[model samples]
Target: MTVHLVGAGPGDPSLLTVAAAELIRQARVLVYDRPSMDAIAALAPADAETHVVGLRRGHRALSQPEVNDLLVELGRRGDVVRLKSGDPFVASRGGEEAVALQNAGIAVNVIPGVSAALAAPAAAGIPLMLRQNSVTATFVDGNDDDEHAEPPDWHALARLGGTLVILTGRGRIRRIAAKLIEGGRAPDTPIAAISAASRASQQVLRGTLSTLPAPLPPPVTFVVGEAAALELTCTSPKAS
Candidate 1:
């Protein structure tokens, strides 16, 4: 039996690849995360056994050691499907899990899916790599508990004029922007907040580093730099 690490994409159900959809339909047992799992589970076989791995707000989750053991144990008994939000390996910890399974002598493969880092800005009409707007880009998870204790070399990113995409940063956007601006990013540097992107209800908000909202951004994805200058024409930005 093989272990399949699948990507649930960002929200829109139709975005699941044809192969991934078929696997979901045939899986006998599936393991997934909470709240985010419902939409993807709806596509699973009616009789599939579902295991929910709930992560409390800022609380400890199933330890990686526990998860690795579970995969080894489960893979030995039957086929297993490990579903993840967005792309499996895109900052979702799926890679680490996949590696554990492989090291345990289990066959494993990852199914690619749409990631919010790219989809969020697309739904907002912003090209992450616009020829005229930006030459390079980087992505950071702002939701990290210690995002900037020392911080990445903002000076380097600023010098190269690379685009910065931040995910899970709902709480630290204002501070992040300040650092970038201080390092060299213009205070007026273009910034956009995208939430629930790629779905019918996708929303976006555009402003400058200096005009960010008071409460700061959300678990949403952030796009900054010249790429922020792309003329996004998808859904209009929600009123601030």
Candidate 2:
């Protein structure tokens, strides 16, 4: 049995990779997280067995370990399509699942998709790097579940002086901003938050580190540094 670990892109169904779509179509068992992925999940054939492991309003949510177990069980039956938001390896816990499946002797294939860390900034018209302004781009997970995971060194990050992209940081942005400032970043350093990236309902909020408004919503990506101040996608007025 083989399991296909596919990245579903950000939120737009059209962003799904051709390989991902083809795998879903042939999936005998389909597994995905979050309701936002329903549009992508719908690509599976009518007879495919489906499972939603992410938290939902009324339904019980499965822990990562449980989901891993479930995938192992399903993999024994036939080809399984496991759809993860954004790129499978980008803060999606897909690596852990892959490890679990491997330990269980299941074959696996991984398909890449666009990650929100890149898409959110682009969709909001912010470049992650500019030759003159920013030469480095750092991506970090703002929400860490493992107590053992070394906490991010905000001071070093502030001193790194480049573009910083924080995923899953919506709820703790205010605190994170404070830490950055305490770490030596300028209070007026530009910061932007983008939510529902690439979707019709996407929202972008731009401000300095000290002035960013309250968190927009969950699934937000925060861009910090000089590049955040540039709106490269803005249409210029007709040349006079």
lDDT agreement with native, every candidate: 0.76, 0.88
- Summarize candidate 2's per-residue lDDT along 26-104 as a digit string, tens digits: 8878999988888888888998889999999999889889999999999998889999889999988899999999999
Q: 175, model 2: CA deviation in Å?
A: 1.7
* TM-scores of all candidate predictions against the true structure: 0.84, 0.94
Error of 2 at 142 (Å): 0.7
Query: Least accurate stretch of 10 residues (summed lDDT) in model 2?
Result: 231-240
Q: Which candidate is the best by TM-score?
A: 2
Off by over 4 Å in 1: 56-60, 143-151, 214-219, 229-231, 234-240
